[model samples]
Target: MKEFIYCWKDLEPISHIPSYVSLTFIACVLTCVGFLYYATNTLSGEKNNAPVITTTFVAIWLFIITILSLQGFFLDFDFRPPKLFIFLGILMLIIIGLFAFPRTRAIIAQMPITTLTYLHIVRVPVEIVLWWLFIHGAVAESMTFQGVNYDILSGISAPFAGLFLVGMKSKSKLAAIIWNVLTLGLLVNIVSRAIQATPYFHNPLMDAQPNIAVFYFPYVLLPLFVVPVVFFCHIASFYQLIFIKEEEE
Candidate 1:
């Protein structure tokens, strides 16, 4: 496994990154799974097998991405549309599809606003991982909080927002909307910076180095799983806050 991972010219050796970094990221992934499971279970209320189906589907998707990343499929940027872009496009489509389908919309409507808000707390550890990656030369400094990335603020404020702003009150609903929008902006800011820091479009504003860590395993999960989940939560929050009546909440 080490050999296959290191064979990629763009990847750093396993020894270069601390074990805790990977462990922490894996923990974050598990936390995401827990969030999704809780949401699905809450919606299901044991009336059906939807939670199991949802978890199985997500696990299979993660497994496929893990296998592909280990095989270095996304590192092949020589093509007209780089595999990285292709992968990102697929993730975007999956998120869009959830919004597009009415069945999924019903599921999203049932997701607890508090859970969606608190789920962002996972980003706090993710920001720490980004810093570790920066120090290890796996990512550009611009992707960390020390640089242009303000996404950490969203993570830090998540708990507070979840605790105070998520309620049935009209003012609370509006505040939730504002919170989700601001955090969603932060998410977009970091994702755009990450794209610019990549090899295909290395903007000088980011750093002297390109952000290549995400092409590797575990790290690839950042873009593949974590960011999309965060994006989904924000959009889901918006749908509920804007469309669902205050009495419904």
Candidate 2:
């Protein structure tokens, strides 16, 4: 274990921003944008409105992330726990507010359940990126499928679940509900392990090398942008399942 940690620590990055890292970061950002476009387009019920809203939201989100990166917010490990909680709290508030507003609730209800399921397929690539980061020794093994992170299973199953939800003329609401619940559990599991592995969490088990890659530029986008998007996707799926009764029609 000591040798493993020593080796990981010794493998320093050649540059702060390498080519593969840049490509992965760009891919992540584009995935977020694509999902936002699909969501706003589906909810707005008008092509023009969808593009406008999608563009606005994507711009604002990107701007916020850029500012955070420029300010080196994610690099501050000492104060990360509080900052992470604050960030997640703000996101949760926004989600709750969207669902609370009647108009937004109606819009959310109109979002296709299959598309929501398909959105989760992005997790497969995300897990792949996590593995890559692990290879570079940027993160702890606990954050990847090689260790405690099993969230990749959901990503693996998402497409089939999505197709099942869509192709079945008489969709099984119970099956969809069960799948969402199980995937949500998987998400929670990885998120909890990630938090525990962070330096701020003071987990002695990972003291030799904590999950610090997420606290840097480009990679920071994972927690700030991608994770929340995934969380919202799951919530949106549940919301559609519970509130929208397709069988009644």
Candidate 3:
């Protein structure tokens, strides 16, 4: 493990951010990563050993992001396009590649729709963390339910949508499809709001608060890992409901 020396700039924010919020966000991060591993392992099966490789790769990617964040690499707001945008773009391309490649698409398709549906429950904690961040001045109200973001609804309804599939015995994929589409729209809404709130593209009309908290360590994981995973879950859910045939439960 490489040693990271923390400077005063990196250490100052720790005193302001509440412990509970940090712990809760950390838990959500673990859950999201663990859930993805479970879903990947379930679909890949023991024969392929894909889970080990995929999870290892994800872990390494996250470690690099975490290190950079702790070093304040993303805190520079003067850079055009922003470091956050660059990393997020990379993540978007990776997601697209997962769905575009035949072999990877096949593996992703095998993920149980029910599992994908419930995986969103992690978002509930995410919203809470955002709300807390707002209270502490780390993020803007526009990113929380009190403002423009309505993503909490998606997290709250995830279980019901998953249960709807179970209750209907997979007889209808329409309910899940509608839910996924609506929730995906919600995801896009907040993500757009977040992007606009970035320091480089701060929109005064949107809210007085700027979304800079994510440029810090731990919180940086929100964009680097949590949001992307949730986005992928919604996309995966859509792919399963629409393109793949649903077998009776």
Candidate 4:
């Protein structure tokens, strides 16, 4: 365990943290924006609300970025734990509220399940970014696939499963359900470990180096924006499976 924690010690830190980190950060942001556009368009259908949808998406991103910049929220590790927990708690409540409210539920139910499934493909690049961060000593080793994380598999299989289920018009809802459940489990596993890896929680099982990178600019966007969106995608999938009916084969 100790060896795994200090595995990156031998490797030299990247010479240009800003340049490479900025590239990866831009990639993540663009990927997330693309997914949101696809999802919003899928839900909006032919309502001609694409402009509104796009505006709303940009507005939300701007809001988050503005807050991050103004407050320097990422630099302070002392207050990060409570802030993150509170943000997560509120996010969960909002997700639950969206599902529970009749109007919002109907809106979400209109989204294509296949699109939700495909959205998880973003996780592939997310894992890759995590690996890069691990190498740079920005995050802990345990957070990557090389250590305890295996969430990347879900991202890899998502395209195939989505294609098979949607393209083939398969009636085996059970298969889709199983895949969603398994992937959801993987998401939860990594998220739990990530929380533990934070300096505040500091689980002994995790690496000695706490996950400090996520609290900084650009990288902080991962936890605030990307991770929550992925969680919502999973929840939205489950909701569709339970209440929304599939077409007859």
Candidate 5:
């Protein structure tokens, strides 16, 4: 077994001084506070309104939370699960039901659109933390450098630079389609690794631990959300137009 050394420059345990639990608690408190403030304002029927979902604000929030989450993972080698995990879990269940049940589709579609909009606000950040854990080469870490360097994109200011480009329009439609095809191809690489691991894919880093149990196919939503939702959601839903035509100014 390789000896593990702690790099104190980037990480500190939440338990020792300011624990991850404490930060989670603070985030929860602030979340509730923010919700209450909005609820009170809405009930008062003020002219100035805050929608339950704010796309631009939520996008920025997701990115900020993701960066902060990396710190917690580095400190403990485990992405600190949220204090509001139950809420998020319920939200996930509703989304899954909406997506999977055709009979529920029409009814679910009628729900306040803002709910899904803001829910993704919360979802994106959580996924980012999970992604960081796998990259950090933790017990469930997949592909990491030296089993310590969590960041595959070490030099770049925004490791997720591709995120910005994925949904944006390019001069080349041919190129755009090609990029999507290439992405789907890349995911196939995991299949080979999965086969090699066989009946069960265990985390080599941890004895008697099965990393593949919770994060199996279909449940392996990290990649799907990355390319399909974040990247392509805007493309089909926001970019190309089949019905609505833009009028010349």
Candidate 6:
């Protein structure tokens, strides 16, 4: 377990942004615009199955990546690199079931089981591993926090992901509103904190800023990408739950 820390630390890819207004920045910006477009439509209460799943998966990945981005949170223990074997194993089982029996996919596809947020349960272990990595210095500082501390936002993948799952599963418009509001609230709050901490983001350039590492906005607002998708998921999930409720009624 102790030796794993070294491996994890090295594997925490440090690919630099190279130029602030570089290709990576352009890509991230485009991605953000795309997210806003799709999420805006979804928030308007459009029901689309493919978009919902795609958004949910993107939320999961973004949340996971953010967690992975943090560095040196853990200093006292030996951290190990996490392998997603368990997830893969479970995923394989789910896949086999889907192929073996049509009902399996049907049952799995059922949405909004309840307020318990089961739709994102598959991601629980990933968050756990990330937490352990943070606790042991396996991961490093984020473009968001610059220097991370043990706090609500440090191990954000879980609760934030939970928020996404919750909003997606809810049937109330109030929930969707709350989800979007929180998404922006949390995003702005964290970005402000990161900017305050990191000199690079002292004066952020909106779309016209020079090509810089923190210029892409992910370093400032790590949740920007995930939040919209998650917020949209909330709308889709709510729509789903309402439909399910009416069917039961």
- Separately for all candidates shown, the number of backbone clashes (residues 3 or more apart, or on different chains) is 0, 0, 0, 0, 2, 13
Error of 2 at 232 (Å): 1.1
| For every candidate, C-alpha RMSD to the true structure in Å | 3.7, 4.1, 4.9, 4.9, 12.2, 16.2
Span of ten consecutive residues with least summed lDDT in model 1: 1-10
lDDT of 2 by residue, 52-118 (tens): 7657876887688668865766544446345756776776688778888887777677666677787
Q: Cα lDDT for residue 70, model 6?
A: 43
Q: How well does each candidate superpose onto the true structure, as a TM-score? A: 0.91, 0.85, 0.90, 0.83, 0.30, 0.27
The candidate that achieves the highest TM-score relative to the unseen native structure: 1
As for TM-score, the candidate ahead, 5 or 6, is 5
User: Model 3, range 84-117, lDDT digits (tens) per residue?
Assistant: 8899889988988898889888888887767777
Sort by TM-score, top down from the best = 1, 3, 2, 4, 5, 6
Can you give the lDDT of residue 248 in candidate 4?
Answer: 17
lDDT of 1 at 94: 83
Candidate 6, residues 102-191, lDDT tens digits: the string is 543333235332322322222233223323323333222332233332223423433444555344453444554454355445444544
Model 6 regions more than 4 Å off: 1-180, 191-201, 204-228, 235-249
Model 4 segments more than 4 A misplaced: 1-18, 44-58, 69-71, 203-205, 247-249
lDDT per model vs. reference: 0.83, 0.71, 0.80, 0.72, 0.31, 0.36
TM-score of 6: 0.27
**Model 1 lDDT per residue over 1-249, tens place:** 234323435345444898899999999999998998887788844565668887997899899999998997887666668777777789889888988888888888888888888899999999999999888877888899988899999999998898889843424777788888899999999999898887777765648667888988988899888898889889889998899886765
